[model samples]
Target: MASPSVPTSPPGPSPSPSANPEGFCALSPDDPAYRVFIDSLDYLTPEEVERVKAAVRFSDKAHEHQTRLSGEAYITHPLSVAGAIVEWHMDADAICAALLHDVLEDTGVTKAELVEHFGQGVADLVDGLSKLDKIEFASHQEAQAENFRKMLLAMARDLRVVLIKLADRHHNLQTMAAVRPDKRRRIARETLEIYAPIANRLGLNKMFRELQDTSFRLIHPMRAQVLAKAMQAARGNRKELLSRILESIRAKMDEVGILAQVFGREKSLYSIYSKMEEKQLSFSQVLDIYGFRVVVKDIPTCYLALGALHALYKPVPGKFKDYIAIPKANGYQSLHTTLIGPYGTPVEVQIRTEAMHHVAQEGVAAHWLYKDAEHSGADLQIRTHKWLQSLLEMQGADSSEFFENVKIDLFPDEVYVFTPKGKILALPQGATPVDMAYAIHTDVGNCCIAARINHELVPLRTELKNGDVVEIVTAAHANPNPAWLAYVKTGRARSKIRHFLRTVQNEESAALGERLLNQELHNLGVQPAEIPAAAWERLVKASGNRSIKDVFTDIGLGKRLAAVAARRLLAEDAIPIAATPGSLTIRGTEGMAIQLAKCCQPIPGDPIIGSIKKGQGLVVHTHDCPVIRKSRSHEPHKWIDVEWEPSPGALFEVRIDVEVKNARGVLAQVATAISDSGSNIEHVSMEGDPERLFTRLHFTIQVGGRSHLAQVMRNLRLIPHVVRIHRTRLEMEP
Candidate 1:
């Protein structure tokens, strides 16, 4: 039989191998396509090529019964994927892994078998690229998310996993015409949303552009057709102009004695479409559709070329960026500037050394492609490793949450900031000092209280700007505020803050939960220590908790009633004893587990009760507060007697309504009185018509206790234009 037709090559720079040799129809070791694949492995040793061929033979046998939607032998798919990997000049193991990637998921081949044949390194690589298809999931989205998480975590361990995976996806996208339209759209969306961004993040520009264009075409075929036609027309119209600019730049470089290769660059259709969709611009409104790239011999020559070009054309102010000085997070380095071309048409130019060009084009792949070149890909490798290491830091989040965080990190419009020591840190745009602090270290982030931007004190939430020298001020007593979640931009910072807060909340909840449970047990005439270990284990099992701590945490968070849990922990036929008199005590130091009810604003001196709110721990409210009284009758079982410690550890917030004349200075006078009484106004607002003679100024102030709140009110009574002052309670009885 004639050899199966070679699969079509994806949209990339690599050339497709010649057609299969005659009389080599079936998948075999002597297949000409396999020969071409092995020939392309010139970077590998002779022994390595033999190893890769062995893997190809093994994969061929394993997939002999499988066929793709295009009716081609399934081995052809792995061969195509391997060809893409070869184009990247990846090592022998990567090519071997690519060849055997689908074996675990598709065939009966085992990881151990692969290990025996190719050793542990190749086995691990293949395992990383394989999906979790054997496991059941709740939904398609969950399965997809989990697979993505698995692949990413694997990629974290070995960056080659992603390179191989991207290649596999690229080949799949190229052959996707055989897929159903709905599935095609889904794959296209996934490619555009996740894979393309990942390729861009990793600095695989060529692959990134190709993935984007193909996905865009599949997702919006009509739009792509229209845009392609429009772009073609625009290209034809601008050809002469682009030629003139290129010639002028070449002449200028020669005149300045700067040896440079200047070539005109056309923007990809997907890029043009994205620009229009993002900025709501028409085709003609997008000015930088055509640009030029100047590749020079050295870094100094790159700057010299830039000067020559600027002299040749009028440079546009504020459109120049020196990424060469501060490379991008992905280790891309180039100088970009926009200029006024002939007839006032805009022209964008990029200047970079030959080495930088390789990096700009290949990104992390440059590390392998140019491994033997004079310019070692060490910088690119380090940058890529740093980013991959961060993926490891993002563990502990659930699958969906992990996927979301990674997506957030993938699309970075970077802003470069400097530490006090002058080390540069690249963060996503809109990143705050908190992100910078986290970028420095997790300890610094946890203890950071404020920042000094350019040596001037600023809020921690201040958005970092390019070239700003930031100094984070940390306090040992400081802890991450939950509010940081609203402003943090980096996934690392967001995840770190969330993880710390969760830990603190869990610990506080467990402590409070134990106290609540013990109180209930005492009410039932039992002591916690008297309960045996077996009873504890049974309680944990019955409560659907992993451990006794989890059971207490559930009770503390109000997910399970402490009274019911206490009863379940004891024997079924135990004798009743006399009830206890003490109630659960509140020290006001329970962190997030014990919260003061906003409506009642209970303080230490108030006769307070606790309401066990689901997922919100215990909410303290004054006994006579109308808000609590309304809900008291409906969920009486949730309400528990709570007494405040003689000395509560923290200040309590309470609201006071001050009726005053509608004068500008009257409000300031009341605030001054509260301040003089050693009370802080957390918030202040006005009610009623401000134009009227009388208005109400509401103040939410933090005070020590009931006596302190009374003192502040007494001070407010002494102020001028203060008509009446009373503590504000939500819907209280007169």
Candidate 2:
């Protein structure tokens, strides 16, 4: 174990890419590659250095007979990857891990043998980096997704895993020219979508920028070449303008009594191209292609430099941000401002302390690289750890959900808002009050009924803005409304809400299934209390379910019919269908388990009949409903005779389609008609031929039963300009 010496800050400007546009590629051992790797380990203890040397020797020996597609020794690939880790000044274990990352996947090396030779730390890192190729997958996408999930989960546990993986990907991308054209495009797409974003989030700006440019070259070579040439031309033309801006900022800083390091940095080609495409602008219109960073001695000096720069030129309103007051989630802190420079050009500038500059560039890796950066770097590590832990918390989420969450985290264009208690909370842009509540806590989200933004009552879906103070209003009885899913921005909020809805739905379905199964059994003269254990087991076995409850749940969910399950569990000819028929008692309290068919909403006096849905419990339909008429011919055996009880209990929903003249007050008038008839409109929809003067308005109204609905319909027919008023009986609209 060794605490490596801190590396000095890298130079301000990037070298010309035209010299080696493919970026870093593997070098032969006869060249400076091995020496460079060895020199990078100078900070390691002698013992640790010996361990790394052993890993390098083992990897070289294992790959002695292999060669890369570029006709270079295979060992050079891992050597190059290890060189990257060493450059990052990673610890001895990470260095060793980088050296042997490909051994397990590409060679005949076993994890057990690696553990015995290199110790568990190195072995575990290699294992995490290994792709799961032994297992079979149905498609390439499936295998890719599963492996990505595996890699991400491992990275969540050990940040070094992803660091090593990123290094591996970096080298692979650097040498992508040797890969087949089609395969190169696939790898480039994955790099652009996944690896590049991960590097950006970790604050590995160098890798992030390189990966993007490399992938852009591989996937769209012509476009990348054109952009590169354009950038080169722009560099020549803008050199004097940039020089003037830098000189002005330096003079202004001197006057303000602030000592700083000011330098101009060009945006990466991919970055510039992305901005142009996003804004639908030409290259000339992209004014912020070149930005300046002013590294001051301390935090106070950063603001002083910013003020000096702002005073030198006209500041672009709303383009100034103080990240020092509210750092980014990645722990980057700086003061960013855009000013109209020498020729009315928008010049973007960032001001930060020297330490902030390092953290901004190196991100979490700075913690291990720079001893002096430990405090701020550790703060970033803590933040990163918390976010990773959130990913682990969502481990039970399905693959699609987990992958979607990772994508959501990839691009965090955040808005910083204040809570009522003065604590700041960061949320994605377009986040609403419900998203705010969920970000606070799941319980708070579940109970949230209303919200007050900036001390004024606001709708839950109101999008929050930066600096707005948000206060959530919760109620004891309030629960998550499914409508919240439409506006929530965070994956956590969406997942939690979906989990709740799914759990509630399952429970309701299971309860309904139990009630239906019991009623069907009773119809066969088998009382619920009298059912034997063997019968339950038999039913479970026949349905291929794990337990009796699962069978009930499936039946209730409309995947199975209760009568069929009951018949399977009963003895042959135990009771005739007409012999001991028992009636199903109805109560509106059935919730989601039992449902009244919306196609023909049946009321107490509507002569109702039950149809055993495969997964859904009994669906009660009016006897003459057209849905029943159509389904009876195809599924006659599923139909069950039923009658509503004297006390139907609770409100019944019925659909009414009204044809009305396209007048402004027609909707209001129809709503008034239903309201005045003692019926509540649950939902409303209006649509019709735009060329015609009449429109079709459909309403789902709540009432006591069929008689109540009839009266409401009669009252609607009497309204002026109401051409036709009729109940819609089709289960689903055509």
Candidate 3:
């Protein structure tokens, strides 16, 4: 059920300011504003009012000896915050929670006390509103990030938590004049970067604009003052222009027999300044500073008013937006257009029904503050719930990753695109097909390999634009590639990809580590499968690892060494065998934990040696590899004997440089020869100039072994245009 709406009738007189010894609010309780605050609460039931009074009385006691930087009683701060929530006509629990939000954080009171007095609902709200105390962070950024995470997690549980928090922040911003100058600037910047965007996404346009303007004023006082003066000066000069435009739109609406309310609207100073800075324009170059909103009685009349305005003034092409048809993700709906006004100046106009106007201005709060006769609060609540759920799903991420994703979500300048079924999907501006696929379904996103945009097949990284129809082509066996993380824009896609990669990488590393450990154990005449459970448990404790698998996984990932583990395990055997020379073998099943050195690509046909770098697992190098020569001079003990298993299963990378005559199709011919030799060229680059009658071509090809690479080179040398060919090794020349 929806919360009660604000009553339309004016309330009776409230108690005077003298009613409380400590201040009831930042302003005198007798002030007209404080009276309006209490009067708005008259709609609440008597029991609810009593609960609110109890909370206020308790908080007033808790903060009895405390005062704010402005010299007002600390209790007055929570009173103002509660007053703001009251203006929104929030439920009694919200108002009560707002009153006691800081009690548990700043006073001797506890959460249990709040629960005993106001119930668990109000206690949870207050706890959610309170900051984490007694925690020391290495940096302020870390502290802020953690604090935001805590609040968001609470909000995910109860939406009221954020509602009260936003109100609290709003009041704090209002009273920021009393804060230290440096601290004020820091808070204002954070409010603009974090809170303002959050308010905007929540459809709190009033709060969003107020936060932006207030933050901008503190962050750049001189710039804000200059912009304000410039706007005032322009208002005087364009007085007649704006007046005529409003009159003309009003007359046009009247001619169409549409009952409308029209008024001149000036863009906020910060908004104008942002536009100027973004577009790199001077004050005079920004033309959309003057605008008007026309609120009609119903939806049909909204379109009619738009038509009337268009008939009277020519609209700037491509500047018209029909948000009414495709409401924004925040449930905002309006028809916006920029028209060529009198004297060829541009004037922006918005047309929406009365209900739309309220929703556009008040956002989520409008459902409660206004009756919302057409739509219930459930609609906005559901959308907010979905958004919060996504945030909660991201809990698997660390603080930094979660914070980064939240910041990305805060600025969703959405683009509306169509699915193959013609269903419109709204995504952020730079969202790619990967993000779109993920939005459809998690499975579809994980298996997506290609996309079709406007019926043309394109790479998955292709960015989607508004109005484009996109279709994802998925393969059942396909999995997410690490490269996709670079282009995917949405938080869901990014988080999902990272989560999948982390899981897969761990599993694979563990498996590879197990094999390496087994080999090491076998060398010491110990069968891995026959190891005692007690022995494994003891080893786990000795290694300070969570489990036997974690020990192997870390070793496989080059974080530890299987040899060290094997020595430790064998040390308990009481029987030792002489070290077996050249015992370990490679079967190419080690996954990413074991890598073939790119300097001298080792294949089955080449003698190879393994070097266990500190953090990089076994690196295989050719026995005669120059890199081994350089390494052997230092940590020769790290080098170990390793032989390629008979019939290696995976392909190895080998570079070949071909000197060929510069001619058309020559590069293609070389590529075809390599392909005919049953090798795939992974990369190609040209070095020598074509105009010099010859060019040097470098090809990095995937081959089975040395024989396969030799076959590829022989095939290339058969070409009549080929001058010379040689295998390329990354070795420094003396």
Between 2 and 3, whose TM-score is larger? 3
TM-score of each: 0.88, 0.88, 0.88
lDDT value, residue 382 of candidate 3: 68
Give candidate 3 misplaced runs (Cα > 4 Å): 1-36, 136-138, 178-182, 373-376, 540-547, 563-578, 581-603, 606-642, 659-673, 689-695, 715-726, 729-734
Worst 10 residues of 1 by lDDT: 1-10
Model 2: how far is 580 from its true place, Å? 6.0
Clashing pairs in 3: none
lDDT of every predicted structure (CA atoms): 0.84, 0.81, 0.81
The TM-score of predicted model 1 comes to 0.88
C-alpha RMSD between model 3 and the true structure: 4.9
Model 3 scores a TM of 0.88
Q: Report residue 550 deviation for candidate 3 (angstroms).
A: 3.7
Tens-digit per-residue lDDT, 349-450, candidate 2 = 999887788888888777777877777887888788877877776666776677776777676488999999999998888989988898899899999999
RMSD values, in order shown? 6.1, 6.7, 4.9
Give the Cα-based TM-score of candidate 2 against the true structure.
0.88
lDDT of 3 at 253: 84
